[model samples]
Target chain A: MESLAAVDARLHRELQSRYEALVPVLRHGTQLGGKRLRPALLLLSGAAMHADRTAKNPLTTEESATTEDHVVMATVVEMVHTATLIHDDVLDKATTRRHVPTINARWNDDTSILLGDYLFAQSFYLAATLPSTLACRLVGQAAQKVCEGELRQVLGRDWLDIDEETYLDIIRGKTAELTRVSCQIGADLSGGDEGQVEAFARFGNDLGIAFQIADDFLDLWGDDDNVGKTLGTDLQQGKITLPLIRLLRHDDNAVAMAALDALRLPPEDRLGRVMPLLRKSDAAEYTRKVAESYRRSAIEAISGFAPSSALESLKTIADFAVDRRF
Target chain B: MESLAAVDARLHRELQSRYEALVPVLRHGTQLGGKRLRPALLLLSGAAMHADRTAKNPLTTEESATTEDHVVMATVVEMVHTATLIHDDVLDKATTRRHVPTINARWNDDTSILLGDYLFAQSFYLAATLPSTLACRLVGQAAQKVCEGELRQVLGRDWLDIDEETYLDIIRGKTAELTRVSCQIGADLSGGDEGQVEAFARFGNDLGIAFQIADDFLDLWGDDDNVGKTLGTDLQQGKITLPLIRLLRHDDNAVAMAALDALRLPPEDRLGRVMPLLRKSDAAEYTRKVAESYRRSAIEAISGFAPSSALESLKTIADFAVDRRF
Candidate 1:
């Protein structure tokens, strides 16, 4: 835990200087307060590799791209994550995110959209300068996957007719791909072996899925005040999460049936009542368990990697199953 | 004219395979029958170092990244152009472009926006793969400049406060920056040396400004059928083009004041009428000379380069001042 905190402090310190100039205060997108999970994952893996290097071909402090590479990778991952958030806010017509105005909410859509492009270009440019072709490919592939995920979300909206397999595919593309790449990119860059890279990527993949499902569960069950976003945001937007998908497959209870009916078309202001009805449907518990399963699998994914302090910190991250609050 | 046709033919031949699979509707977008200006500048300069290697570097034949890079750069420049159009359409809310339904007109404000992001990402991913740091830096910087230019446009919009120098600066950022980088990128990859890269970049810079002026002229003077875009689209959007700007500064005529009033606070339906009054004020002729002035300068920028058939072809593109029907 001490090591994790130190690495995170390092990441925050690095991200600070990027704001040397006075950028305008625009509301409505990536307001900079989220889990910082990607950066944490990136730095931890890099730190792990740095430890591994010290045990073998250790650095003489001056030769370190150790922390520097992690910071840039962390910052770059955050940028990719930000770009996705900007676009997703537009798609979701989401008014607020992390308690701040989403870019789509503040600026006219055109400016917000171009701003997203600007960030994406920045991310790519930074990634290009990194030492590995593998890093660039990971970041680039993640970006492409993010776009694909959005398109799938658009196509799947309110279409209860779409299956669980289809739903899982969309979630993986949107949520898990970048997270998986985050681990691979950090480890692979910091001299992690192929085996280590593979294990961490698998861990990230499972964690990303579990994290997203946990968020979905919270959207229905948690207090909106703490979540820092509107309750039933997904349902109002007609996005079907795993819990609802699982619930629909089972009893098809009257309440569940009604919620599904709500998605047969576009939703307009009916969610105040629909939210409670949705809660009564048992979808929340089912979703929580599904998320727990992914968290369990993510922990298992890291088992092949030798037990190290970095692996331990990753276990705490996995313990974030329904446990971490934004 | 014959050379222009040849370049256009070469462009089509190059696009035949990579984007033939693209939806026919989007084909006009990614493969507008423009001269292959950027890649030509690259291939032409790539040959400058060793003319024989020009054959070795047949931009069309080179397999490393030619198809993806060329198409991506082409698509990106067009995407930047399209994002401008989407914003332009929102500002203008005008209906047609290239005589087809604009995204803004075809879809609502929001969808046109996200679609623009989609196109931007697709183009960006293509550019991110080049093996040169210079290429990534150029693309990233140009993208930021485009955003800044648009922001400047939004701010300067009809303050009657814009000066000729400021106007030129705007065009340099909005249009010329991308054009200049396109050539610079082409030159760098083609193995053009430092001096050669500077010459091509200068050529592109001058050409971009000249092209913007010509476009400004065509907005007031050209026939609609030839341009495939509406006449006075800039005026309809309340954009203060060079013609209008010059008239405001120099003309004290009663008609000038009337035109200014219409421009300053334009009527909803009356945007279509400003063109005729603008024409009557002799603004069109003045704008043409302004455009031609830049064209002459652009030709001078090429004088530093050694004479060759490719250089001769490059000159023809700058000659677009008098030759373009639009």
Candidate 2:
């Protein structure tokens, strides 16, 4: 938690600039608080790996990672995540995020786009300050994956046949890739061995997939007050998420055809028609089941690490990834 | 010229990706042929510095830069330029660039924004592959400056008192900064001493300012076909460029008040009113003179280098920066 506080402080410092036009927008974007899941994962992974290594070699005097490195890397991860959220708000035309007006709402789409770009560039600038190009390379590659996945989603907005596998692939690139890179960077910087790094990456990937599924579910069914943002946007945008996909693949032919018809209607009307059908089917339960499966896998991936508070936190995060309403 | 060809090939190769949704947009963005001036400046700076070093020490066995290094750095610079253009098109709502439909026009603003982000990430990924983080640091810093400049321009769209110094500062960040970094990276990678790198950066910065001034001049006075893109966008968008600033500062109080009133008119009508007033005054000549001054300064920055074909090319580019129609 203290490390997360450090990340928050560092993020504010990094966002500071002489450009008065960007300062207010940057503050608003970062202050629209969500769970700092990515940075927390990075810090916890570094702590767990460091503790495991130290436990294994009580007499060895290997140098552990400095708190500065963990804080910097966590800040970098959070910046990338925040940039994507700002751009996504522009694309979705959503006004509020975390119960606050988004950058796009408070400013404009042009400002949102430019602010996202500024944050992205700042992230790379901070990453390059590290002793090696490893962080830069990983963050760059992960950012590319995020864009590719978002592009795929935008292009496939009208498609009616998006299935479970395609949805998984999209989320893997869009959400899971960054989390995977975050954990891997943490483990590697903390001097974890190759296998430990790979294990942490796996944990992150599964946790990220589960997190997105929960997000998709909340967009469909959760209370707006609890979610703290706009809901039903996925349905309005004709974004075929796991629940809709499952509902469309219903066993009853009439139900399936009706769901297809709902998607074909105008965006404003489609949500009303689709929600009732989704509620009648087992789609919500099915979505939760899949999310829980991924959560279990995430927990199992890190089960081999030596028992410590950090390891316990990682497991708790896996549960939170699928269980949280917000 | 062959090196430019190599830069083109490297750019095409770098834009290749597994995402089918992005391929066509990336191709369209990159293939909208601009002058490629940034990459050319980089290559010329590197070559001039290399040739000067070799000539100065014929007996020394100092290694020269490989073609691959030049090509990669040039590609990185061009990618950054191309990315900014795509995003700018969205902000300007310009339908055509280089006589072709912009990505935003052909697809949409969302696609253009994501594609720009994709290219930005790809540029950083490629930069990180180099032997050092120098390129990443410089490019990241330049990109942040660019966004800052653009943001300032957007936020100042309605301000009537934007001065010459503010205009210069905006252009310095939005346009000159990237060109400055391009030359700096080329010289640094090609083994130019620190002083040489700094000199090349100055050359780039001055040339970029001259280039932008020429661009503003052409936007108002040049034929649309000759400019190869939509013109008068700055006037339509209420962008206060250098020429416009000079016009507003004209000694004739009546003319300055008329120009201000024209800017206050609706965008569709303002261009016509402003154009007639601007043509009646010496604003065009003043803009040209300022651009020519920067051009001379750019040329003077590199006059100390030893004589070579690359040096001649740099001077020619400085001339072209101010004088070209497109």
Candidate 3:
């Protein structure tokens, strides 16, 4: 808790000075009520790996110094996440996010767009402070994948022909890529072996995919009061997620056509009609099952690590990520 | 010319496989007949610095290998410029740019925004591939400044209280910063001396500021056919550029008030009403003088360099950047 607070404080301090005019918008975006999942994954994975190494030998000065590096990297990850959220609000025309007025809504689209770019630049600048350029390279590639995934989502709006594979690919790029990079960097910074690094990368990817699946599920069916953000946005925006994709192919396309018809109606009418059909067609159940499989794989990947608190936390995170409740 | 063509070809080759759907928009943005000034500055400065070093000592294997690094850095700089253009179109609601339909106009704001992000990520990825992290750091900071400059511009729209210093600061961030980094990286990668690197950076900065002033000039007063893009967009969008800022303060605020009033009119009538006042108030002349001074400063910054072909070309570029005709 102390380390996390320090990380958040660093974020606030750095952004406050980075652009004085943007401090308010930056604060609004960064201080939003996020779970900070990516940074937590990075810190925990790094600390766990370091602890394992130190068990064999006393903690080296250089290794101990990485406590500072972890905070920087964690801040970078959160900045990246916040940047996406700002742009996502603009793309979705979202008025409120995290129970606060969005940057786009409070200011305008132009400010939101440019502020997002500012945060991205800030993230890259912070990431470059690491000893190796590997983090920058990985994070850059992940950011590219996230943008490409978003482009695909925007281009494919209201798309009916998208299959399960394509949907999985989109989510992988949009969500899984960043989480995978986060874990990979964590392992790399901790001097984890190549196999450990690879396992954590896969773990983060599988867990991220499962998390996004659960999010898509919650967007329609979950309690808005619990979610703390807008619900039914996917349907209102004609976004085709896993649930919709599954419902599309159910019962020889009958329910699929009905689902499509329901999407075309007004938001209230559409959700009312689609809710019962989603339950009856097993789409929600199917989505949850897929998430469960990914979660199981995420847990299995970390089974090779030495039993430790971080490894245990990783296990809990996999389950917590896909759990039905918030 | 051959080197620039190679750079463009490399850009196309890289983006073609990056994202299939994005290739078209990428081509549209990158191949829109830009002057290729930033990359040219990078390549010229690099080659010149390299030539000077080779003269002192026989080229080592590593020294000879920067041909690839130069190309990569040049590509990265151009990618940054292209990304900004894509986003600028969205912010401006521009339908055309560089005599072609803009990404925002051809597709939509969402695609343009995401594609711009893709270009930015691509730039960073390419930058990180360089052996030194300096390019990444400099370019990231430059990109941040560019966003800050843009935010200031958006926020300053239709305002009449801006001073000359603030206006210059805005252009410095919006325009000069990237070019300055471009030249700095070029010299840095080529192993230039501290003096030589600083000279090129200043030269790039001055030249970039002049270029932007000329662009602002063209936006209001140049022939639409010669400029090959939509004109009067800044005025229409209430952007207060150098000429407008100058005119606003001229003649004890009389012409300034008239200029402000003219800006409130429709696009077609506004240009007609403001053009004569701009000329009468000497704001146009004042802007040209400012641009000319920067051009001279740019040339002066490079005066210390040996009488090499690249140095001579740099001098010519200073003049060409601020030339009245495109």
Candidate 4:
């Protein structure tokens, strides 16, 4: 938690710009209260790796002093996530996020776009401060995947024949890739071996997928107050997430046709018409089962590591990814 | 010219995406042929530095073999430029660029935003491939400034009292900063000493300012057929460029007020209303004189370097920055 606090402080510092006009907008964009799940995954990954290594061989004083680097990497990942959220808000046209007005809502699309871009550049600037180019390279690759995923989703809008595989691919890039890279950076920076780093990456990837699946479920069926943001945007925007994809693939031809018809309605009425159908089907249950499976895999990915609070935290996060109502 | 060709090939290679859907969009975004001015600045800076050094001491084979690195850096700067243009088109709502439809016009705003982001990430990814983090840091810093500048311009929309100093600051961040870093990366990567690198940066900064000023003039006065993109969007978008800023500062209050009233007209009429008033004043000549001064300074920035074709090219570019109609 203290390390997370450090990450928050570093994030604030990173958002500071010589162009004073951007600072408030950056702060508003970043300070929207999310779970900070990526940063937590990163810090917990680093701590778990450090603990596993320490149990076998004591770390040098220099090795032990990498908390600052961990914080920096954590800040970098958080910035990437925040930047995506800003741009995503512009695309989604959703006004509120985490019960607060988004950058696009408060300012405009141009502001949101430029703010996202500024955060991205600043993240690389922070990563480049590290001794190696590894963080910059990994973050770059991950961010590229994030954009690709989002682009796929945008392009796939109104795609009636969209399948589960395509949905998974979309979430993998837009959501999971950053989390995977967060864990990768954390574990590798803490001196984890290739196998351990790979394990952490899998853990992050599974967790991210599970998180997105759970989010898809929430968008369809969760409470607005609990979710703290607009719901049903996925269906409204013609995004065929896991629940809807499952609903579409239902064995009942009439039910599938009904779902398709509901989606074809105007954005305003589509969510209302589709919700009742989704509630009647096993789509929600199916989505939950898929997310839980990923959660289990995420836990199993790190099960081989030495038992420690950090390792337990990783396991808890995997559970939280699916179990959280929001 | 061969190096520029190499830079183009490298750029094409860099725009390739694993996501099949993104490849066409990325290509379309990057291939909207501009002057390739930033790449030229970078390559010329590298060549000029190399020539200056080689004149004193015959370079080793390894030293002479950095052409690939120069091309990569050149590609990096050009990608950054193209990314900004993509996002700018969205903000400006420009339908066409380089006599072709902009990504925003062909696709949508969401596509433009994501594609710009993807290009930015890919630029960093390419920059990370180099041996040092210098390119990454400089590019990051420049990009941050660019976003800041654009943000300032967006927030300053229709700001009637915006001063020339404020206009300069905005352009410095939005336009000049990236060019400055392109030359810095080129000179630095080519082993230019601190002083030489700083000199090249100054050269780029001045050239960039002059280039932006000329662009402003063209938006106001040049033929649309010659400029090759939608012109007058600045006034339409309430963007207060140098010419209008000068017009606003005319000795006669009535003329300044008329310019202000012209700006306040409907977006469709603002450009037409402001054009004649601008022509009647000394604003156009004032803008040209200011741009020409910066062009002179850009040429003067590199006068100390050994005279070579590359050096001459840099001077020629400085002249072109102010002289070209487009």
Candidate 5:
């Protein structure tokens, strides 16, 4: 629970043969510095099922948990995460990823898209080996939800009237569902009861929703050096995040429509005028408070999960997503 | 066995809800297409397994000589094929597919990518509900082979020096695997003996390899109007397909190198020179003979399958792939 090193090592071991087969591509393509939060959730949730068990992967030494279960679950979580990023890079027109050129940037659109599907099939190959039907269904349904979220987001892209409900629905699908399933499946694979599994899943969803709200916040207000994303970048892209949505609702002035209309201005000319409009309307503070409320709600949701070191760590991870310096 | 109307209808019926959910996207995206060739193979193979049994699908009015065994087989086979297309579209950077704007083209890359994954998961869900674990494992292994094939293709892209053996390996992984497993799993689901299942699988693999080779031929030699794919498109992309590979030996000559190098030239000039250089060399004739040889091998392979109406239809499909006229 303290760190994901053992799970990471086990995942690396599973990837050994594939990594070798795909050495040149893996070495160059899949950068290896991710937090592996999903895998850790899987491992930790597995631990929570066996009372008083430490959440760190025991696959390192004399292992009790099935090797296939642990390794497959870990790899699947990573694969799902990677597949999303592959698509995300294209959607965001994100040229740089992990300080390296994205797959789309490097290989053009087709190969990048196909590679994402390759990772997906690889993930399914891994998941199909799990010991439980429940695990398979859980993973399958989560994947389905993620697609729904993506479809909604695509529709929302140019909707200038976008609001919190649509935004929340997008985040729930995009971010929360997989995180929930990751923990829930790990618990199921570990022989956990339905109640415990459901609790962990709920915890994951609430945390993910809050985590996303904060990410939206950082896109506007956070320091660029620390966040590593440009401030007001979302505005420049003409996205109506929580703050902008709130500003649209809060203003009662004569030029409110004109101020809202500014979002449709050319992206290159966006930021200069929008920030002051936001400040005059008190929208930024209102948005931050909404995010903070979601954060508190996230903490409250996990209270349904009983006390454990793993539960505590989950809380800490959520807090770090919002409050960390970097 | 003949046209797979019953099984195809069943697959359509079972997938109606998911397809309905995807309808808006599908209308924009076209999952409807040319002959559902892969699903036909699966259904025909399934029919061969239980020659005397009565099976039925309520969705179809077609009087099937073979029952619902083909239905399950068809669904699973289509899932695998659809999964591959989703991935391939990404790899090919194909914005338009089956005469419709592609999912990747209509939706941004991420939605299309995830939708593919969702389909894959749905395939596994559909596969797991069937009669055997062996079927699941067979399909799983085939999916892995696809991943390996794609990764290998990326590793060897634009090599120009790639030989026939390497090309065969890539094609086997990319195309033949799902065909092999599709036939195998279908037979097994319908209670075919071990030898019968294995034999049918081998036949399907050979057929798939032959079909791909002929398709490659069509890409080069057939009229653009007849083939529908852009003319000499593979050469333009610097893809080292069979003809391209065979021609490279003669390509050491200045005229050939001029054509090979023309990929970097202006698009019109590039095709003008490359097309004639390819035609003048023995590459076209050599690849044609190779495709004929594979088609012959496929016919020979099916000789081991138990003789039945279904088996005869399967043989016709393979012949249709290689020698048929549009």
Candidate 6:
């Protein structure tokens, strides 16, 4: 958490520019903080490997210098996340996020759209300033995947028959790929071995997928008071998440019809009525199982890496993804 | 023109990807096919230097190898342009571009926004793959400027008091910066001298400003049939351009009031009434003179480069920016 605060400071320092109108929005996006999970994963990955160096080779100078690169990357990954959030808010027509006014709600859509683009360009610009093109390439690849995935989800709206494979593809692109890259960048930069880097990559991929599934679960069933934002948004927006998909795959057409009719109701009332039906089926339990399985894989991924406290932290983080209430 | 066509072919190949829903929109945006001026400028900048190499240094293999880089950059720059066009369509709510339906019109705004972001990521991805970070840095910087400029324009939408200085800043960011980078990339990759590269950059900056001014002129006064898209769109959307700004500086309050009122009318009738007032004030002529001044400077910027047929071509391109009817 202190490291995340440091990342926040770094973001403020990096994004504060003379573009008078642009800087405030950049600051707002960065400061409208979420869990800082990605930054933490990245930092912890590098820190884990750095801890490994102490027990193994203990080369201080080059390893110490790479720590700064990791910090820069932590800042960049957060900015990338913030940019996507701004754009997603616009697409979802969300009025608030993290109990704060959404960029689209505070400003108009044009400004929101352009500001998202500005943040992305700023992130890439910062990425270019790094010593290697690896970060830039990875970030670009993730950005492409995220956009493509978002488009797929947009096009898939109102289609109730979205299969499990389609859901996996969308979640992998929209959420998991960036998380995987964040971890890979951290490990790869910290002089991680091939196995160590690959391990972190796998850990991040599974953790990210699990994270999105849990997040979707929260949207439907999480505490509205503690979540600090509107719930039942996916249902309101007609987004087909895994739980809904699982519920649809069941053979009972009558229950499916009732669920569909409930989804068409207002957001405030739909989740209340839909939850009972969702619970009557095994959909929620099944979704939780899938998420737990991925979380287990994520924790298992780092088992062969040199043991460190940061590795334990990674396992704890993955568990948090499955176990958190919000 | 053949070179521009090559860039077109290259864009088709580069943008063709496995993301089935995204590829068609990407193709549509790239295939909309404007003047391809940015790509032409890029290719000519590289070719001009290559032609100079034959006369001066006579290095063959490595120099010829970079021609392909030029082609790749040509495609990247065009994709960047197309990306901006896609976002601009969403911002402007335009239905058609270059006589075809815009991506925003064919799909929804969300798709257009995501596709614009996808193209930008793809462009940067391509930039990163090149042999140097110079292109990536230039592109990131230009992209940032373009977004900032667009945001400034959005914030200044209905503000009638936009000064010439603010206007210059906006256009420099939104239009000139990318063109400058395109040419600078071409010359830099072709191994041009510092003077030559800077000259190409300056040439592009000036030519781009001139091009935008000419385009604004066309929007206000060019024949609608020839322009092949909607005319007087800037006025219709309440966007203030140079000609209108110049006309507003006049002491004739009654005329200014009449012109402003006419601009609020339907697109069909606004130009009919506003043009007389604009012509009487010589604002159109003033805008053209201003454009011609930049055009002259653009030609002057590259005059120091070694004489070649491509240099002549660059000169002709400068002339065409001023002299073209469409």
Give TM-scores for every candidate, taking all chains together and pairing residue i with residue i. 0.83, 0.97, 0.95, 0.96, 0.86, 0.95
Candidate 2 — which pairs collide? none
Candidate 3 local lDDT, A15-48, one digit each (tens):
8744466667777878663798998888878876
**Chain A TM-score vs. truth, each candidate:** 0.84, 0.96, 0.94, 0.96, 0.85, 0.93
TM-score-superior candidate, 2 or 6: 2
Model 2 regions lying over 4 Å from their true place? A61-66, B61-66
Tell how far residue A142 is off in model 3, in angstroms.
Answer: 0.4
Q: Which residue pairs show backbone clashes in model 4? A: none
Off by over 4 Å in 5: A1-3, A14-21, A28-33, A52-68, A251-258, A301-306, B1-22, B28-32, B52-73, B86-98, B101-118, B128-137, B155-157, B250-267, B274-281
Give the Å shift of residue A226 in candidate 5.
Answer: 2.3
- Which prediction has the highest DockQ against the true structure? 4
Instruction: Give the per-residue lDDT of model 4 (tens digit) for B228-269.
Output: 866787777778889999999999999999988888888889
Candidates' interface RMSDs, in order?
4.2, 1.0, 1.3, 1.0, 3.2, 1.2
Give DockQ per model, in order: 0.31, 0.77, 0.69, 0.79, 0.38, 0.70
Fnat of each prediction, in sequence: 0.19, 0.69, 0.61, 0.75, 0.31, 0.63
Query: Which ranges in model 6 have alpha carbons more than 4 Å from their true place?
Result: A1-3, A59-62, A251-253, A260-273, B1-3, B59-62, B251-273
Following a full C-alpha superposition, what root-mean-square deviation does model 5 have from the true structure?
Answer: 5.0
Tens digit per residue, CA lDDT, model 5, A1-326: 43355555554554443424465444444463266878877776665554333244334334444345765776777776877777677767877765677877876665566566666666666676654455555666677677767655565546677777877877888888888888777776666566767777776787677677777877767777766656777777656677777767764764466567677788866677677777688766776676667667766765754467666776777787666532
lDDT of 6 by residue, A209-256 (tens): 999999999988888887776788888777888898888766799888
Candidate 3: residue pairs that collide: none
Kindly list the per-residue Cα lDDT of model 2 for residues A1-326, writing each as its tens digit: 77899999999988887867667777887886478989999999998888888888766737753368889999999999999999998998989888789888888998999989999999998999888998999999999999989888877745687889999999999999999998999888888889999999999999999999999999988888888866788878778799989998999989999999999999888878988899789999999999999999998999998888888999998988888863
lDDT, model 4, position A125: 87
Mark the regions of model 1 whose C-alpha exceeds 4 Å error after superposition. Answer: A1-22, A26-33, A53-65, A131-133, A252-257, A265-282, A306-309, B1-95, B104-111, B155-159, B251-259, B267-282
Cα shift from native, residue B146, model 2 (Å): 0.4
Over B1-326, each residue of candidate 6 has an lDDT whose tens digit, in order, gives 56677777778887776867666777787767588888888988887877776767665524462377888888888878888889899999989887899887888999888988988888888888876777878888899899989988887646477777788778999999989998899888888878888999999999889888888899987888878777888877777789888877767888888877777777668778888898789797788899999999999998876798778988898888877773
lDDT of 1 at B299: 71
lDDT tens per residue, model 4, A1-326: 78899988888877776666666787897787488888998999999998888877764523662488999999999998999999989998989988889999999998999989989999998899988899999999999999988888777645878788888888899899999999999999899999999999999999999999999889877888998867888877778788888888879999999998988999889988888888779998899999999999999899888888999999988888899883
By TM-score, highest first, what's the ranking?
A: 2, 4, 3, 6, 5, 1
Report the interface RMSD that candidate 3 achieves against the true structure, in angstroms.
1.3
- Candidate order (DockQ): 4, 2, 6, 3, 5, 1
lDDT of 3 by residue, B1-326 (tens): 56777888888876864556666776777775378888899988887677667666655525652488888889999998889888898998878876789888889999888888888888888889876678888989999999999987776644567788888898999999989998888888888878889988999999999999999999987888888876787777777789988887887678778888897788667778898888788887888999999999998987866566777887888888889663
Judged by DockQ cut-offs, the docking class of candidate 2 is: medium
